[model samples]
Target: MPKIALHNRDGSSNGTVDLDDAVFDVAVNVPAMHQVVTAQLAAARSGTSKTKSRGEVRGGGKKPWRQKGTGRARQGSIRSPQWSGGGIAHGPSGEQNHVKRVNKKLKRVALRSALSDRARSGDVRVVDDLVFEAPRTKDALAFLDALEIGSRRVLVVMAARDQVTGRSFRNLRRVHLLTVDQLNTYDVLVSDVVIFQRAALDHIGKGSRPDLGQRGRRPSAGTRSDDADLGQRGRRPSAGSRSDDADLVLTGREQE
Candidate 1:
């Protein structure tokens, strides 16, 4: 398992946390990451560019000249493709689809590969929590200063409920804030460093891989053995072994 130092909001060393092997220790897949990133960028295109075709252009109804009288290559219409103001022959039709379909498994692999690459490079940081009293850009800047994250593009992943942190970080030009649900390969790869709140990291480890059978649930103390065994066997832990609604219980115990 990959272990990273956990820090407090003021950048003091608290302890360390073991990252999920499935999410942050996978072998990096460059090709898969490239493909997924390409698809993601392609999907963002609006594909709304359209050019009028020859048939759709106005003033094409009346033929400019008779078949052979004009001796001008038998003029068809003023708006013919050969004319100066002619419509485009083969151009974008506004309905063109630029979206590329990538397999869900490939996307997951790419994301994990990106995160693993960052982890290996020591660009991943985990913070215990970010409980801001209010949204203040000054406090956000101080937080970054404390973390020594000077000017470098940083990706901050926080829980959805932590809107205060989101707002606090939004004013920093170099800081990109995203909820855990919005985390993806492109954003992770583009950032110089990635900071994850402890709760968000736990949620990602448990929920990102649906195949692990740990979605929306925390592994109870009793299921640690099963998790280890599944990790060794390259399979999912038994569903019966996980305890639903255990997040609050586990969080309180861990904090204590």
Candidate 2:
């Protein structure tokens, strides 16, 4: 287990917390991190860049000159690639797929590797909490200043429900706010320091793996076992009820 110094919102020391060895003390895999980070960056591309080919250009319907009997070399459409202001050749067609496929296990390994690297470099910090009465940019800055985190790129990981803290840090230029669920290899590798809320750290530690919490091991609201049972009951009457109804119907027929 790797232990990191814990701090209050005001930067006061508040004991320490043990980070999960699986997450923070594992062997760093550089190649896995590189592949994951590359894939992440590739996925962010819009891939919408496009260029018009000669055939698709507006003015290409008319040829520039006859194919022969001209002093100059024969010419085709004015929109040919050789002509100025003409359509581009072999250019992007707006259908590019820059996304690289990385397996879930590889992604997890990469994230853990990045985190372990950061932890070994002593760039990981834990804060007790980031409760904010209101969204205050000044308070956010003060928190960073108290931690002596200067102008470096700081990645703050917090619980998803902490909207107030997120709002406070959103305006900071170098401070990136991400929920625990959004933590990934690229963000972790690009950051100079990682600040984890105590709650977020505990949540990560409770999981067996980096992304285990998101794997839907337990059913969520509206999808519980009880709900499924209720759905089954609503769809079909019980055997006892059917037998009782049949007996009642037979007795009614006998009386009739």
Candidate 3:
């Protein structure tokens, strides 16, 4: 099981808590995380972009000119697509659907993957509690600063309702206040650090995967290189079979 220490508001360790292995110990699936984040963003789109078609534009009702020569071409309606002030061609209908369907199982898996990635990188922090005497942004800001995350991007996950905390952190430009139920793969992956209230663990489903043990392992050196230097042509060539990258580029060109 993956475990993390619970910390006080002053950033002192209170105790340690074991995380649900299913939610925080799975192997990171980069592709799954990417796809889930993409889907979550897609679902947020309103897809309401609309345009007037040629037929919908104003003042295109009557033919501008008759056929056969007043030094003009034959006309149907002045609103035709070929004319100025015409409706759009193949434009949006204001009914486009941007929602993407990710199955419940896959969503859970992706969530686990993202959380695991963060946990593996030692970025998930647990706080024993975050109650406020009353709603105040300064307190929240001070709390985050004490945690060493005030200047960094943070995602705070709370279990119980705390409207005051929500209001306080919501205004912070670098902070995202989210309830346990509202937690998803996208936010988990995007934030530089994730702070979870101790009770928030209960909200994470108990579906631990024991097969994926330790992670954050790097790939073989033979396969590792900066992508910007080589593009997507895969791993670097071995020493014995080494050829100039320019030659490889030429080979690709020749194949094309």
Candidate 4:
């Protein structure tokens, strides 16, 4: 991979950095990336929605009238779902849970895939450096205008944080500033283009660790395995301590 030079406001070079092909070279697979991104977003939902069944609702304890001998239709409990102020037959309750699950590896891959897609699409705008004269939205708006990103959602990727830049873009609904460390699949996928600082590319790439191998089995230091020995084996205590104590006690008794 070629080293890309990053710059300052005056078009001065900040530094040149190289990007790994493995991280940024993968062909963009829209279908696979879309599936993975959708799954991740679905998993993040609270899913805590619930509908109240007839029995779950309050009231409707006593029958309204006798079951027979009435001119009107037979009457049951006043709280019946069919009656007003009665228990709801099937009303939405607040308890319904909408949370879904996505494999950890899948989540990581989706993010990397999105980044690769952005890079391939030529939608990545790399700035050598970022400058803000003051903490104003106008300064932020000017940068967006210069970058030709007006009226579109842009993901501004910075190496660390530029508080001035952050504050400047905070109020702009169309612009989102994400530190390289904070970039995620949803934001990357949602944006029309990704604008990143040149110096921030290394930081972004460093944070973009691919979730290699199978989706479910991500090996970590915390995981236990049959093939690995994690700690020292248990050992027996010294065996002669009790006998020595017994002898000392006997000797004391004899002396007394």
Q: Which candidate leads in lDDT?
A: 1
Residues 1-256, model 1: lDDT tens digits = 8799999989999999998776777799999988877876666566779999888998878877788766578777888787888988898999987767776666667777888899999989999977688888799898888888888888887655455665676556567665565567776787899999898787776553223233322212222222211111222222211222122112212211
Residue runs of model 4 more than 4 Å from their true location after superposition: 1-19, 30-32, 47-52, 64-75, 78-97, 206-256
Q: What are the candidates' C-alpha RMSDs? A: 12.7, 18.0, 17.0, 20.9
Per-model TM against the reference? 0.73, 0.77, 0.72, 0.63
Off by over 4 Å in 2: 66-71, 208-256
Between candidates 1 and 4, the one scoring higher on lDDT is: 1
- Taking all chains together, the TM-score of candidate 1 against the true structure is 0.73
Per-model tally of clashing residue pairs = 0, 0, 3, 13
For residue 165, what is the lDDT in candidate 2?
70
| Candidate 4, residue 53: lDDT | 60
**Candidates sorted on TM-score, descending:** 2, 1, 3, 4
Give per-residue CA lDDT, model 3, range 1-256, as digits (tens): 7778889987898988887665677778888767766766665556788998987888877777777779777888877777777878889999998767765555656667878788889989999888777778789888988788747778787764566676666556577665555556766666789998877664453321112122111222234323211211232122111111111111111221
Order of all candidates by lDDT, from best down to worst? 1, 2, 3, 4
What is candidate 4's TM-score against the reference? Answer: 0.63
The candidate scoring highest on TM-score is 2
lDDT of prediction 3: 0.62
Model 1 scores worst on lDDT over the 10 consecutive residues at 227-236
Instruction: Superpose all Cα atoms of candidate 1 onto the true structure and report the RMSD in Å to 1 decimal.
Output: 12.7
Cα lDDT tens digits, model 2, 9-126, are 8899999888877678778889987886776666656678999988888876787788878888988778999998898999999999887777666666767788889999999999
lDDT of 2 at 49: 91
